[model samples]
Target: MSYLDTSDPQRPATAASDTNTAVTSHAPSDHIEMSEVVKKQSNGHGSVNVEEAQAQFHALARRLTRQSTQHNDKSGGDIEKQETFDLLEYLRTTSGKQDEAGFAKKHVGVTFENLRVTGVGGVKICERLMKCHDEFFLSPYYLAKSLVGGPSAAPKAILHSFNGAVHPGEMVLVLGRPGAGCSSFLKTITNQRGSFLSVDGDVRYAGFDAQEFGKRYAGQAAYNMEDDIHYPLLSVAQTLQFALKLKSPGRLLPEQTRAELNDEVLSTLLSMLNIAHTRNTVVGNEFVRGVSGGERKRVSIAEMMVSDIIMNNLLAANTCHQASRAVVCSWDNSTRGLDASTALDYAKSLRIMTDIFKLTTFVSLYQAGEGIYDQFDKVLLIDEGRQVYFGPAKEARAYMLSLGFRNMPRQTTADYLTGCTDPNERAFADGRSAADVPSTPDQLAQAFQQSKYWSRLVAERQTMQAEWQGEGDDPSGTKGQFLQANKEEKRKHVSRKDPHTVSFFGMVKTLVWRQWLLQIQDTVSHLRNVLKPSLIISL
Candidate 1:
């Protein structure tokens, strides 16, 4: 873990924002190519002969490559040697590290630019009037499809000219109130495209195009939604075990090592999240008793923080063989319900994990406390559909001051910035009268663009992108920043067979044992539940 030597001469400081945060940029590059041999070996498909699968896979790869070349030529993108990854090499290195270290440095970097997302909001009342006729014998759906009548007329921009870069070992905070386009920004960056949304952007991960990032590099990035979803029937331990077993990189590590790592990760999560007491609690929903909401949010974080080695293996096993993993997690308002102390603890844990694992995390929180706010490496503030600011969290107040906005003395930065654009809070800072001061999100955005900070950022972006192509720009190169410092490390290698060492029978036995233990631990609660129903029936 301490293998990476980060004590080299400090690299040049990135663009300094008003908050003293460094802003860096990256250039867009090529797509990632998965080789036939690597693809075949990545997933454990034991039913077929390896040689035949390899041949078939190679044939398909050649054909696709040929077709892709023609398509790229037509699009005027040059046909260069495609960047390819070695599956065996990656597994040999990645699986062992993930098992022992809880995080495998995937050396992934994310860069997005000029992102614009447009979509129609809910149908207007006048449009709904047309839809009311749908209950009739002949559906308006035919007419709507033929003429492109309904949604086509109402399309509006949700995000316009959004831009940012997130490198590994950094936790970027996306801050905005409801409908300010923070969630949409995360979704567009992560390439979670939907039918309603029309997205235009250049998104790259680890130098590959975003489509490749989302498909082949499945585990490399994850979008954590606001709502935490889980099967309430499964206890915490059972749920975690199921995820680990199903997605574990098969044969990458010895059976014992994999098992040990799994235990270690689960235990660490319990301790970090302060949920050890509820390790066996069923993840109940509104219909049943279970862990509290704040505790459940921690569970969601744990799920996203699973080892990328196994995540990539899970995707590759499904034959979607462009390989990579959840090096980046874009969480949407994940700490909404937690108290200040708990949220601080949760944010601190994320910071620690990000440092150790070299994870690029994007979290959208509305009103974060000072403790949680200070933990962010960078901050992306979205106002309406425009980027209000993107830089260090600390310099935000100064940036605001330069923009004719004021932060009341002793007011927390989060509250001040969140409320600055409100019409009612207009104690103008830049000699403007309250009546003329910027109030709406749009006004704030305009004021920001007019400020000197905007010009500085644009200039900084040019320089940053120019110097980005060289080696060692990736934050992953800074080893032991979190996990180990000044400590040497050893390596372990294993086969595809090693990861698959755990069998179906083993899972069944393990699951049953875990379930029994959960029941035993919560015997009193279970008895009370059972007896309450019986007593009611008797009455």
Candidate 2:
């Protein structure tokens, strides 16, 4: 296993507040303090109260002293000099009484902007832009794009387009029908199209444009396709170790460093996925050996996190903050034990950026249970290829019920989907015949064309249409196009061995001779047995 090479030049620096003053004099903390001083003085107009002005002056002086101390610890360079000049200008502008209010506003704005920049830039780079223009964009990293297909194509599409995005510490569920392109989606995202498809697509790693994204995110993502588990080969640690080796070859920590890294990786994974009990347990297999399905999923995740790239990304994403903080505390009255501060600290460490856009196709999400609908943020329900409902999950269910679809208590998502296509349910409630139901893939595709979901998709498509509208309508040279020139063209070749070869006949002759030799030996043994019996009788 070898680590993939990445060309991103900007490596993430240490966390803003973590730098030691002895090492880096102009610490991020000092910059923050200086910015705050500038803000306060500017907010205080020239006619500031004597005591307040004095206090502000002292604070500024203290911050400057700290900055000086830090600067003394390290040799100043062009970057440091530029930073110092910026801070000085900020201080000078804020100290003057005439334009205090204006200076204060500008100081606060600069401070916040710097913080934002630092935060975004400090995270391990995991993705980059592959192709970008005024209207069209494509990430080097592949995302699962689900679409409908016929029975034959449906399975392939489902496997190809059914994928979930896992960013470092978080787990994303790729929910869809058995043939709804989930597996195919995983293969596409991971760039394993050769194994899944006879034809290849233009695949590249995510973050190719931003080299850091490629370097940090290259092998951090893991996929667990729906396959039967084979449990006999290795222990849990061995399995994780193998996966880690594949993810990061040269970059792996030495044995002494591995103990801490392993603990951190295992703990982070267990806490995030809500599975911590099966740490050392063997996964069970029929007449062999393994863990349960859920445990296997956790193990796969663990392997990904052990990689340096994944760990760095996960830390940057603030996923650890969420996992650490969401602890369920139990108090033992006898022992008198409960570390509330520690628990709170753990909780504060985890954070997740909210996803602004969420798209779900009918085939992607099915109804789970009644209250469980609230668990999901967005929902899109599709029947055949058409969108039946799309909105918040709760609202979608309500809309369905209003449209005369009955909701049964304790009904699972699979059951709800089946009910949607049931003939009796439709006829009794809406006076619709079985003809209304979509039977074939073509019909389903047509229905999808008529639905609101189709309309939304069309609208999105039109927005992007202008970018490539005149770039050759025949689609011959488009960079990322998945469609091929012709469907029937053979893209692969195979060679057959000649059946009349002497080598083939020789193998058969050898087997026959061995069988003959065994038969002769058996006959000789039988004769010996008969002779021994006759000799005994004569005696």
Candidate 3:
């Protein structure tokens, strides 16, 4: 529950930002091999299984080295060992942190109580009118009339009085049928409250409150929409690199330059996510031939993961903390286009990052498998935006059964919980009548509120807030640690309040370079437009 500990030397001096965390670190040497660092870290940490971790790292290194050798043989030894060594070093960074203590990483947790989301979207267009054209005119007139009469009734509630907490290194699986407000809940937590007309509740990121968090650390905590969005012609590497460069910190780690750190982070992400093979392939749309649909989905995921590394290289230069800022991400059905195996891989990758960096992740998945489900530490079930269950993932099934719902044979727990939201899909236990059991979303929500789980959540939240925020005059917590880390990473010219690690001009320069690269790569496509206009003029 403790948010900040500036006194701890082992703890990374990391701070989260809306757009980025400007953390950097210094090393003894500019060219220190990560192999030596990993060895030192292994010797230092008593709890970690050094042999097991080293075995895994060595296996990956050997494979990558073999591949590099094979490619060099074909290309007449043009590729150097430096690039391969850098990639392995990046791999070691995440691997080394996996066994570290909580204080050793940039850690943060999110807690939300009485979270109510309301929007002006309960009634559908079809339901609003019998005629399409007549509806347009009536809709505006009805609104005007309602305004003239008096203050209107409160908007429909998309999510009501939901309470949950996700600590660092934990993942929460959000389960709900479509239109059950799953996406709304994710949007609210990741500081995308703009999507909803009203959000009434207390949401805290460590010691930072909702308003303060939204204003300061927006991109550090982000929500990834279900669909993928990228330039069709841009290669996967280019797409990811553009994001990495824009969010890059102003400072550099002593062990690596800006380019080396960026390369390391980028290579680590692509390798970990199993998309390294597609790094040079374009993320194509339906009209273009390029990487597979699944690879493109991974590109979206890698793009989001870029936020984690942006701060890693910046904090170590000036402070004792060598860790990057922890990230909290809410993914809305990110498995939309991915197959079952790929989805599981994606979930496992998330779990690894969550463990290594202490990331807080909220994933809303439809028809998630057991493997994928097992990765999450907790689960939240929503019925028409009303939370029916929120507790440990393993306890969700029993909690529902205690309420008289019968689990179908061969049905996965994920599906069974999802079925509880659908009247037609759920079955009641013997001797349990409709009157005896909670059937409607409202009744289910009320039942959950009365359960021991609800009481526990409330108690935990209150205790965490009290501990993190502190009582009495001292008022020591994350705010002080956050401010200090922010100050250290912040550049001289950048405004004190600005969240981005890179300056505006730096971002512009990077983006302009990207645009120029895009045009350079597709000169024929760019020239086509010019030639077409001239041909038309001549005709």
Candidate 4:
């Protein structure tokens, strides 16, 4: 039984009919099947509710744990998760039943709480001004500064006390400006932290610790990095196939069954992630012009985990295409290097895959287009690793406005909110004294902690947990529907801020012009210096 059952149910049907059934023979093709789940969104888009999705993902993760597993040699927190996930997933599908024979118990989900990560502080202790305009490192100031030794080493706080959750069945878009600690947060959860840091946190799956989660039901969570790396010579198809072979339940399943599973898995993942076109193409590197940047990013996703990559090649070699109840661990910024249109398209593609495959995704992004931003079911906005907002993406605008931030008209939602975090860029309608205005990311985080926004987030999380407890460990969705869950009411608010006068492109142009001017000034100054000596000689 494959950990994730894609063949189960309910392709959302707005394109169906009932009156004249084809040839009037069997049951109506348009009618909702017993296994089909209907989704209704208040905003007209049939997106899942944030709280509801979390409950469902966690439940699915719990349900996917197998009693007895074939592969027992998988080691480490990361691989073990994949080994269990891939094996259970392979068994689930091969066994030929979605729920029966312990196949349904292999869907894995993830949750993390109160995460705080810190590292060594900045590289300098004090300002060392040069005595001369064009000076050498041997200057008195430089020598004195060197004598004092390196700047006082202090612990750098990368991620503040961050509390958030990644629910299944929804795409969580984590956004922040540069150095906002997005990478730090993602790394902490994926257990990818370096040796120079201190981390205090707990990531639980179905109410279990991260290590135990990997042991019992691993591979529910898969991470996609920003940088995409691939072997230049290996064909894309060959790469995915190799991943499949390595992670598939080879020991237990017969060779033919494994082969059939591989074919099915590979075909499904390629089609779902929209990279089917690159199947036979060689995954090339810088030296070899192979796939496009976007495609390369897709390839990185295809390699998240041995179990999950099998799923992506197929996901957490963990569940179905690396997601079912699989937590989509994405520092979604993986698209930052791509153009705006490609980045937007990539987000859309991810949204489609999440909805179609019933997977949960947690993605970190620096930018989100109107189209891309709306596609996400939930948005997690963090500043310096502090939770600014955690709820429906649509309500963020109003929430900020209520806090006295006016949005720039036509400005991308991502920029407007992140801009507010920078006190210099923000001006509250309520007005404030210099002392009253918050400064720095930490101050912004502290302000949020004191505001109604933080209270709201806490209440929302508490409510989600309360409801989960009351309703038991399962979502309202039908049993075996991995990503399907409750359709509870989402908090909604009318956007109160008048649109501002800025645009992302306009800002970019402005910065470009400023840089151009600076460069020209430097070039002219250099010319003047050179010509001054020549002019004196001529005279």
Q: Provide the TM-score for each candidate, comma-separated.
A: 0.63, 0.39, 0.73, 0.57
User: Lowest summed lDDT over 10 consecutive residues: which window, candidate 3?
Assistant: 17-26
TM-score of 4: 0.57
Top lDDT hit: 3
lDDT of 1 by residue, 96-127 (tens): 55434433235455667787889877665443
Say which prediction, candidate 3 or candidate 4, comes out ahead on lDDT.
3
Candidates ranked, most accurate by lDDT first: 3, 1, 4, 2
Which residue segments of model 1 deviate by more than 4 Å?
1-104, 124-153, 254-257, 308-325, 434-440, 450-539
Off by over 4 Å in 2: 1-182, 185-190, 195-222, 228-233, 248-259, 271-277, 289-294, 304-367, 370-414, 421-428, 435-441, 460-539
What is the Cα-based TM-score of model 1? 0.63
User: Which scores higher on lDDT, 1 or 4?
Assistant: 1
Top candidate, metric TM-score: 3
When 1 and 2 are scored with lDDT, the better candidate is 1
Q: Cα-based RMSD of the predictions, in order?
A: 17.6, 25.7, 12.2, 18.8
Candidate 2 structure quality by residue, lDDT tens digits, 1-539: 11111221222222222111111111111111222122122231111122232232233323333333323444543332333433223433533441322211100000000000000112233354444662144322233222432233222222111111121122122233443333444433443334532422222221121132123222222333433343333446545544432232212222224344444444444444333455555544554336655455445534433432222221111111001010101111100111322121111111111110011111122323222222233343433322333333333333334333445434554345445544443322254333544533344334434544445544543433333344434333221111120111111221112111123344465456545644675576568879999999999
Candidate 3, 1-539: lDDT as tens digits: 11111222221222221111111211112222223222212222112222233233333334333343323344434233334443335434643342232112345688998899889744433235358888777888879976787444557878889898777777899999999999999999888987678899999887788898778666567889998888888899999898877666554443346687577667766765667778888898888778877778888988987876545432222222322343778999998878765565567556655654567889999978766776677899999989988888877877787777765656777888999889888998778756777889988988888887888888878887886767323213354545544544544477757776667887788889888877886786668868999999999
Candidate 4 per-residue C-alpha lDDT over 1-539 given as tens digits, one digit per residue, 9 for 90 to 100: 11111222321112122111111111111111222222323332112233232223322332233211335334524332442443324433554443332223222344556777888876754454756554665677667867887656688877767765544456677788778877776666655556446877776544446665444333345556677766665667667766555445312221236566566556655654456778887777787668876677766765553344232222122223222223445554776556554455456445544543445567787766665666676667777667777767766666566554554655677667777777667665445333544545655566557765466666655654544445454543222222221000001221112111123454465456545644675576569889999999999
